[model samples]
Each structure stands twice: as C-alpha cells, then as structure tokens.
Target: MSHDSPLQDLDLAAGFLEPPPRRDTYAGWQRWRAGRGHFAPAPRLTLGQWRALSPRERSLYDLHRTATHVNLPLQETPMSLKVSRLVNRRIRNNALKTRPSTRAGVMVTGWGYQGKTETVCEVAAAFEDAWLAMHHHLHPQPTPGTRDVHAPVAYAQTPVTAKPKSTCQAILGFFGAETKRLTLPELIRQLAASLDDHGTKALILDDITRLRMHRADDQDTLDLIRAFMSMNVTLILVGVDILGSGLLRQGHFDEHTRQWVLPPSQHARVHGLEATQTERRFDLVELDRFRYTTPGQITAFHDHLAGLEANLRLLKAPPGMLTGGRMPEYLMRRTDGVVGLLERLIEDGCQEAMDSGKETLDEDLLDDVVLSLDDPERDALAGEVPAIPGSSRTRTTAAPRPACARGRGRNTVFDDHGPRGQAHG
Candidate 1:
C-alpha cells in the first residue's frame, strides 16, 4: 500500500468509499446495519507539505475530505442517549410478550430538528442486528413451509398526503409486498400478515404527525394505527409536536404531569352496552434541544462543542476554535441550541474554512455561512438569544421570499420544505 493516498486501502473510484445505505428499504437497512461507522478524515498537511504533494494526491485528498466532512459520524447527545435507552428497553420488553392483546407502544414527540427519527432508528436497527445474530439469521419461529425475510424492524414513513390506505400501503411496501389492487381492508390484512410472516417485532412509522385529525382520511388512519396494536408489533410513532397534532385528541391532557392520559375507548356506546376504556398505553417521551439556562446544561453544550471540534480536520485550526471564549454563546444564538442547525452551521463553516484557505473556524469566517432562517425552532428562539457579533441575529437580508413560499411552513410533517426528520449531531 502506498503511503501517499489518504485512504490507503480503499479506492474512491471503485466505490469502496461510497456513501451510506438509503435505510428506507429492506436491503438498504441491512447494508446500513452491516456497514462500519468510521470514515478516514483527510490527512492534514502544512502549506509546505501540501505544495510538495503531486496534483493527483491533492485531488484525492480533497475528494476524501469532502466525503469525510459530510459523512461525519452521528454525535450522541444527552437527548439521544435518553431516548435510545427508553426505546431499546421498550422494544425488548414488547418483543418478549406472547399475549394476543396490544403491546404498549412508544410515541416520541419533540420540535422539528430534534432528531427523533434518527434516535429511534438507531436503537431499532441495533435491536435487529442483535436479533438476527441470536436467531442464527433465521426466523425464530418460521411460518410453516414459507420463506420470508426475517426483518425484526419494519421502518416506514408516513406519506405527506396521508390516508388509511396509503399508510397501510407504506408499511406493506417495507416488506416488498404487493399492494397494486388491494382494498383498504385487504391492505391492512396483508400488512398484518406480512408482519407475522417476516417476523417483524418493531414497526417504526416516522413523520407520524402527518396524519392530521382535520382530514377524514387522516382520522381513519389514526384509528387504523390504534387497531394495529393488536397485531403483536411494537409501534414506534415518531413525529414533531405530536401532542399538538390532535392525534391524541381522543385523550385528555393532565396538567399536573404534563402528559396525555388516554381514557379507554367507548366501545360500549356503539354496542348499546356499558364498557371500560381500552387499556392500550403509549409511553410518550420527548427529545428537546439543548438549553443554556442551567450550569449543567452549559457544561453539556461546551462538551458537545468539544466533541465536534475534536473531529475537525483543519490543519491550522487552533485548540478551542469552537468551544473557547464567546464562540459557544455565538453558536447558541445562531443555532438556537438545536443540534441539527448547529451541526449544519459547523459543517458549512468547515467547508468555507477549507475553501477560503483559512483552514480555521472563527466568528468572522462563519459569518459568510448562512443557515435557513426559516427554521421554526430557530425562528422561535431568535428573540430570546440577543444578537452577538458575527451571529445571524446581527445579519439581515434585503431580498424577500417569493409569493408561493411566503407564509408557508418551514417545519411541518405534511411537507418537505427543508431537511427531512434526521439527526445531525
């Protein structure tokens, strides 16, 4: 192996250094689960060393840097750690129950850019990895004479234009099942059958808040989701502002605990007899952005910045480039302490630093990098964090947004105006 190339063994042209799997399909999920986490960062070189390298090596190093910067490993924050533990434990408990009744599901609710989906998916994928290994790559209890993929975790996204039939089709599609001519009932039946046939125990429905209660179809989809609990799959519903979405309108919110308490379904009224509320429970958890009010929170934020700064590949980068002095406070203002926005700002700053030949991040260099001001979370927090030097708070744009995009939601479950529900830090 030559010592010149940054990535000694892997060839970028041969696709050995390709990006990660899509994670939306079965094959992609399997590939993602099996893939390693590390990506070799481009070797940092002094100006003299850089000048000595041949043009080929320089190009390869640049290519490698591009890949490494964007594909930086997922940062585990306090919110992610908490959610992961809760989700993994619940899924494990649900998978063990042999009962015919509904297994308790979990609903993860938070603001946009809070990384709900990524946290849940990481835990679910890890569960599947351990499950397959334990089962010797076979379905633990296979259906008689039938050959089906043992997908312990079935992941699906709620369609933007959601309905009962469309939602069912999405889940069914995850298992590579056919739904061309199937009716709504047929689709649900097939979905249930597929879950059993494929030995799926956890079904994650991301962007679940898209099922608004105002629409008749969406309401029907909500009911269908409740009905799915009886099918022996632990449901993981991930969405933004789920409490405000009216998905839990059927339940009452308790002020004391700040949680929604569901009263049993009133089935007896339709049956012309007295009945108790359904005992189905969904453990609702929240993942919020970092706050700087408390001393502990401030320490955590500094620690997170330290982690990001440690991974930066800038050759001229000084220690405490992001963590020292007023940088953390400036970043808090720019990003509203949202992990996704913070990561974007840093990544863009890194790119700018490399391109501008600065090779170091500072307040002035990051000023040129603009993040989406349309972010609802950032917009909401703008008033609280006072403007600082080189912060987006101080910078103003004269150009107005177009008419079509004006008054449009920047963060909502029904549309993809910005980044999808993915974790950045």
Candidate 2:
C-alpha cells in the first residue's frame, strides 16, 4: 500500500488475462487449440511440381486415378497459392506494424463446388501454420519474432441468415463456443474476449455471401462486420460470385462490378482501386474456369491433363497418350474452360471406366459421359438477351470462370423440359 506502488504504473495485459467466454470453457479452448498439431508445411511436390512430373514408364498398375480424383481439390491450385501468399502478407504486415492502416479484406467468390471452400481452407491453414512455425522454432534462447507469436487464424461459416447476432455467433462457433442459446449481448462480449484471448489477427468467413441481406438484420450484420474490422480483425469473405447488400453503400446488385452498390452511386470496387479505398471493398480474388485460349494456356491445359492421365488406372494408348491427342482441345470446347466441369467430366468418366470393368477411359466412354452431363441452366443463361437501346450495361457472364469459374453445371432436363436432348443435353 505504498504511495506510487508498482501496480499504479502497470497496465494489465487484457489479452493475456481475460477469462474464456461465458459459454466457452478452458476445455473448449484446448480443444480448438489442438487443431494446431495436425498441420504440415507446404508440400514438396507443389502443384507446379506435379505438373512438371511426367515419365515415359508405361503401366496401369502404378496409377491411382480414384485417389487423384478424390484429392484434386486437396492439391494446391495456383489460385490457392495466391490466396495463401495474400493472407500471409496481410498477417505479417499487420503484426509488425507500429501504426497499421486499415486491415485489407478479401472477397473470394466462385460458383458452388468450384473450389472456393478448398481455397479458403488452404489460406486459413497456411495462416495458422505461420504461427505454428513461429511457436515451434528450435532455438532455446528467447528470440525476437518467434517469442510473441500466437496463432489466431479462425475459419467460420457465415450463418444462413444474415443477422448480426447470427454472424457474431458464427465467429464464436469457430472458437468452440455454444452460440445458439446465448443472448446477443453475451455473444458480442464473449466474441471480443475470445478474439483478445487468442490475439486473433484474421478471420476467414466461408460462405460469406450468406451474410448478404435485405432486411433490418442487414444493418445489424453490417455493423457487426464493421466492428470486427475496427478491432483490427482482417476479414476474408468467401462465397458465391455475387455478394449481396449490407456491404455496399448503395445496396444495389451490379453484375459487372460483382459487388453490392453503395448510395448516391458512390460504389466500392473489389479490384483495381487506389490504396485510399482499401476499406470500401475487399481485395477481390475471383476464381473462374481454366480456358485453353492461348498457346501457353493450351500447353498448361495439356500439362494438367497429362498429370491426371498419369494417375489413370487403365492404359489404352501409350503413356501420356491423352496429351498427344486432340482430347484436351475437345475438352476445353465441351467444358467451356470450366475447371469444375472438366473435373466432373473426368470423375464421371473415371467412374464409368471402373464400373464397365474396362479400367480405361476410352473416347466412347468419355463421349457418353459428356453427352449425359450436359446442362440446361447453362444453355438458358447462354442464349441471347434482347438488346435494349441506350443501356450500355452489357452483362458479360464469364467466358465461365473468373470463380469467374461459373459451372460444373447441374444435369437439368433439356430444353422444353424435353427428353434429355442430346444436343447440349
């Protein structure tokens, strides 16, 4: 009780001492933190290395086609690499800054099953691993950067309903809280505390388009999201190509910008904006189909096919015969350069090969599968739109990707809901 005691001059470390959220216990903290143990570093055979791997050895016994099909998305894509690099740079910059500017947010949008989730998961894992690496650094002596490192990367799916309370609850769910029964005030308080407890730097919100809104909850969710950003939480929203209202100032949906509109025509640009407008729209990373439009593109396309064929179970032609054939060209044409569609076609073809006891995806089997897999919705979207005079807004559906990767389109009944028409069935 001395005058000017040491306690008088000490600022308590709230992040270090804060108790767990009301609904979350120390057990939950350990459970969630246990996830850190499972991650492995970047693979030795990176996707590029996979593409580069090609040998002339001829044998169906060595290939693992089924495994390849299952693990296609698990293997890193260029898009995934780009996303990881972006997340790492964002976290590293923010962590090291003395007076950081607004955290950079990113919106990764694509059609469903077009690898959005996988890409986001990769980014989240990569972010989490950085801290893991920092924590497990070898030297026994106290180190500068590694000592204070704490892993705070959280991945949570946005709720189906775009309410602020729901969104808050979702963020809390990732940290292992029981969110459903908690009151909104309790949710927010616990959420902030958890963020502090983990020293969270980034939160990857998957299926973020679900956060889109049209009701009063719109403002609520928007405010909540804004509050997270204000807390120095870098938010990455992953979802469908179109992000709905609440994020936009105007609240209108625009096809070209691929962002919600803001008020009085003041808008946010997801990509290509100046540094000053960083807060308005996220850094846009759009994933779309892989087209074989250029010579280099075609070679890369062939390389991709070659990699897949390398793993195919049955060998009908010479090893890597698919690469030499005009099949890749035909594939690009049929698939319209949609990677998901292409993969689906390959997957179905592989299944047919296995089912028919032929172990080989011959041209006829691929042909039958392609005919059966053609989509109706894509046809409808592709058909002509009557041009309106004086409206310069030409809606350009991605040459189907961009997450501009727009399809692995569903098998709807053919036109007129007719008996599966073979013509682009």
Candidate 3:
C-alpha cells in the first residue's frame, strides 16, 4: 500500500493525551491571558477584542503560535510510511534469518531540503518509539547479536572525507563502541558485530556523497558497504545520487550471492542480483513535493495547513489559512513549497505581525515576510526527477492527478454572496 494507508499501525499518539478540539467560532479573537488555554485569543472573538489585547499579550501569543506551527515534514506521510514498511520487512527478515541471505540494504536519496533526512529520521525513530510503547519494563535487557535491541534503528552521518574505515568508525561510535583505539579492519568488524549485538535492524547513513570524493575513487568504499551488508545488517543509505559512483550501481555478484534471507521483489528494480552500469542497482524514491493544489485529500499541503490551524490555541489565525483557496499558490511562490522553507517563512511572518502589532496572520504579513525570501521563477515542482519505473513495491494505479485550480488558464468571478461562479473573467 502507498502512503494512503492508514497510520493506525504506527500508534504514535499514545500516552501524551490530546486536548479536546477547541471551538472554531470563525469570527473572533479574545483576551490573551498566558494561562494553559487562553495564550491566544479565541478564534470567535471580534476584531476589536483582538486589537484591544496588550502588546505583551500578543508577543506571548505569537510565541505559542510559532511553537505549534513550525515542524518537520512528517505530515507528508507517504514516503515515511513506505520507508517504514521497507525497513520493517528488512528488520523482521534479518531477525528471523534461518539461512544465509544477501539482502541489499535500502538506499534513500534526495536533494537538500527535500525532507529526506527528516523523513528517514522519523522512520528510524518509529522503531524506538514502537519499542518503548510496547515494553512493560523500562529496563528490559535486550538480546545482543539480534534485531530486537533497545534501539532497533541507528542513524548517523558520514564524515566529509569518510573512507570505509572512517565510515565504520562513525557507525561504531553510534553503537556506543570505543572508536579511538580500533584498527580500520577492526573497526569494520566491530561495527558489524555491534549491529547484531545491539539488535539494530538498520543503520541509516546520511551525507555520504562526500565519501565518493573523499577517495580518489569510490571502489574501495563501495566494497566496504558491500562487505558490511554481507554481514546481514540492513543499511539504509541516504543522500544525493552518486550518479556513477558504483556505490549503488552494481547488483549481486552471482546466484549464490542472492541466496540471503530476503525474497525477490519484482516491482522494485533494486532487487536484481547483477546489473549493468546503465541499470540502477538502487531504487530511487523521491520525497513527495507539495503541490499548489490537489483534487483529493491524499497527501497535500492543504492537509498540512489544516493541521497548523488545528494547533493554534492562543495565536491569531487568519480568515483563510495557508491552504485556503489562493493561499497555497501564493505560499508556493514565496517558499517553493518546501516544508522547512514554508515553516520558516510562516514563523517569520507571524513574528513580524506580532512585532508590528498586527491582529491576525493575514496576507499582508505573509507578503512582507516573503519579500526577503527568493522569488520563485517557475512552478515549485520544476526540475523534480521523474518517478522511476517498476521501482515501487506497493505502488498502484490511481486516478490522474488533479489540475491546480488557483493558477492561470482558469478564471472566474465569485459573486459577493454565493457559491455559483462565472468563468473566463
């Protein structure tokens, strides 16, 4: 299943109770008392009531506003769920490996600010979160050399000039192993041992692009990764396309090499054992980019905007949120629809409004905040890599994507009072 699958399996919302849904009066703001609830004016309060709040109250309210609004792009749940599924299957297979297997590790690559790191981290965190949620005893000792350790997923970054040895050392350090005294070969062996010892299902290696340049050639580095995975620990590599680095270019050596515990995945191109240089050895799944508009509710920036609106207990919310009607189009132009960029721009705008004593986060403040941000020359999704063919294990044919309704090529006039509209304005 794609990201459209329900997140009930994640079970992430346990223990930390949720507050009851606040009233959505849709027309007012109220007194900004800094108690547990009234940090921001109520949404139903009149405009005059909001303006009457003291500047100190507004500043406090803005702080609360920023706190709830700013977040990583976890709301784009498709990639997160897909990655979790792949990693979960790998972890389970490794834990239950009855015989030798050569299951290749997962490699996730994306450009900067594509939410690759954050999304993978969230996936990694889920293992530990799930572990913590299910365990009755806080101090339960984990079995070493298995995939059921206290921390099932480990994450780290490759050094700027990381060779195989350095990469091993960094990973070893994450395992809480002493790295200063080990030899290079010893480091690699220890890292493998630690993965089994700590029950780590997968090791997430990020910023590994520099490893290619760290050496005059990347052959040894590729061999190092190959050797590590041969030990049966799944490695989820994250970074840019190494292009011809051979890190993700070569398939399995022979039929014997493919006998490891994993089953073949016909839908994913990465499951092949041996491939030509022209063939991709690793599957490429680009992060879901936010669209200016979408026809359906499955994964869109509109959902993200709706989430932000739900959390603002004490901050002033505008009539139309960041997703309302024309807002996504305008916001996409200002921030290019990157989650991090969008959040920063919104936070800055909220701060500016509170500082300027503006009552609500409106189009005026947003326009001002984006003035300092670089302007978009084209559509936010421009230059995105095309979806790879036969690379999705659970991808299904669906309805064609909807046309964005806010931009050019569509025109209409909305009468002051009704839902009916006139086209070709």
Candidate 4:
C-alpha cells in the first residue's frame, strides 16, 4: 500500500494565526486594530533541541518561523515616534473642539519605502484603540445609524483614476455604503452622514499623491477634499513626494516653523457646493530614512539593529549577529538606511540562512543576495554618491554578487552613500 503524501500528512494550518487584514474598509480596519501587534515571535531552539524534533514537527516549526518572520513587528524609530506624537496630538485636539470650526489637517510626504503608510496607520490605530476604550466601546456621539459599524477611524485609499464622485465613493465604501447608481450629491450626503453617524475623529486618505492637478477631474477632487474638512474629521493624508505632487498648489514654506502653508483660495465654488472651509491648511511632515552620521545617529541605528537581532529565530544566531562590527555597516550600504528595504534584505537573508543550513546572517551570505541597487545600469543612474558625514573614506573592495542575481530597479535615483535631505521630485 502507498504511504500518505508527506505534504498532506503535515497540517500546515494548525498553529498559524489569522493573517492581518487590510485597513481600507470598516470591517478590515476593525480586524486590523484588534490584531495589531498580537503576533508572537517564533520560539528559538538549540541545535540539539532542533535535532530532537521529529521530521513533521521540524517542518511545522519551519513554516511557523517563516510566518513570524514575515509578520515581524515594525520597529519604532525616531521618525515614527515623532510622526505618531504629532498625529495623535492633532487628533486629540480636534476631538475636543466644542466650537464649530474646521480642524487643521496634516499631510505626510516622503520618499517611497520609508514606512510613511505604516507609521501613520499605526498612529491612527492606536488613537482609535484609546478612543474606544475611553468610551467603553460605545459610540461617544451615536446617531440613528442603520449599520452597527462604529468606525472612529476611517482609512481609505485614493482611487487610481480618481474623480470627485469616485473619491466620495471611496470614503463611503469604507462604511459599507452602496454607491451604485448614486448621484454626486447623494454620495456626498451619504459620506457626510456616515462620517457624522460613526463619530469618526480621523480619516486617513493614503496615496494622496495619486491626484494630478493638471486634470480637471483631479482638481475637482482636491476641492472635494478641502470641503471634507468641514465634516469635523481630522484628515491625515499620507503619500510619497506629495509636496512636489502639485497637491499643495501655491503653498510657501515658513522658515520659522518649517511648515508648508497653503492659503485660502479666492476662486468660486465647484459643483455649486459651498466649501466654506476654504483655508487648505495642512502641516506637512516627513518620515525620513535612517542616517549614519553623528554619534546619536549611530547609536540609534545600532539600537534598531539590536532589536531586529533579538527578534530573529535562527538556531545558530550569535548574540550580535546583526549589530556586530561589519554587519551593521554592510546593511547600511546595501539598503541606504531605508527601513522597508532593510527589512526586506534581512527577511531574505534569514530565509537563505535557514535553507542553506547556515542558521546565521553574515556579510558573505548577504553579498550573494542582490537588491534593487545591484544592477550596474541602476547604480550608474543613481548619480554621484555623497560622502558620509564626519568621514572621508570610500568603499574599496566589493563582494562579488551571484551570477544570476540581477536586481529589479525601482527607486534608483537615491544614492546609497549617505542620507539625502530632499527626495528627487
């Protein structure tokens, strides 16, 4: 008789937790908030202990470890902490306004893969958690709403081909409102009603840079966003390179406060909708990448590395595997201090280590793993490297990459030598 398939014999789903849900809708946002930061790290095992496990048990443990690695908690950095404090303060201040006035909103602009979306989402989720607990899990100001969805924090993405009506529908979609055959006026009314009924204190519109002002539809969509301020919700717009995206048309930076300020428009209303809250004011913030310059900067980067090293589940991982002498510098060079890229590199490196039986991360092993910057053409396009601050040295010997390891280039314009004050528009 044929034995059962090994894959079928092992229960892959036995110990896995429900995966984290997207935060784009009411249901998803609630599920995400409840499950945020709930993942436990994979158990570390000694080589002897690993060897003691049965074949099926080892396979299950390996799969569980992979899941834990993929779902590693986002490390708290200086930039992320500052963003959270500022965003939470704004939300708290907006919620306490007894007077009828439009709350000042915030716009977060940064380069791609700098954790802008994750940082803002974390802040919003934390705020919602506190707000709900304060109200004893009841809507503080409940309207006669049909659905029982008490969404205090609404998160929606800007549509790819966004128009005024479609933008309204996007927010309404978060509340599970039916948008089919709905007119623009009906859509706005529904959105406004939902926002009021659900007691939403903050509305996060991600990928706000998707709107191009050159198009009439996009310009109208911007006006609609301005009008949304009067609905008594603090708007948090997160995007990449939003300052240069023409979203803040005619905004000037104040040298004293260092904020890009947008004055009220003097134009007539669009769609005959009176956008009384015409002052398009937003405090532009950026979640910057890591820098390797000063003593404080070096300490911060080392602390970050130490945190990651502690979370790793490799059986043979040494105490300072990630934070040791050359590993940190090598990682900095490979990722250019970007958090997302660094995480991806470490994740891939860990997978390689486990598969190759090395069970540890190092320079030689990481050298074989190519990143988006590995392509020679992409490296050339990345322009001249800026010398590291407080040092005047250059890389001499380069580790040879694998033969078939040509990287896929995306953000090749940012040089990897040092931190840049501004992203290329």
Clashes of each: 3, 18, 11, 0
Model 1 over residues 6-102: C-alpha lDDT tens digits?
4464353335366667666788778877764645566666666665667776667666666666656677888888889889998998998886666
lDDT of 4 at 6: 26
Candidate that would win on lDDT: 4
TM-score of each: 0.84, 0.60, 0.61, 0.82
- Runs in model 1 with CA error above 4 Å? 1-7, 10-19, 36-38, 44-48, 253-277, 373-425
> Top model by TM-score, which number?
1
Worst 10 residues of 1 by lDDT: 380-389
TM-score, predicted candidate 4 vs. hidden true structure: 0.82
Q: Compute the lDDT of residue 187 as modeled in candidate 2.
A: 78
RMSD for all candidates, in order, please. Answer: 5.9, 17.1, 16.3, 7.2
Which residue pairs clash in candidate 4? Answer: none
Off by over 4 Å in 2: 1-65, 73-84, 98-101, 137-151, 243-246, 249-281, 315-317, 370-425
Using TM-score as the yardstick, the better of models 3 and 4 is 4
**Residue 348 CA error for candidate 1 (Å)?**
1.2
Of the two candidates 2 and 4, the one with more favorable TM-score, higher being better, is 4
lDDT of 1: 0.73
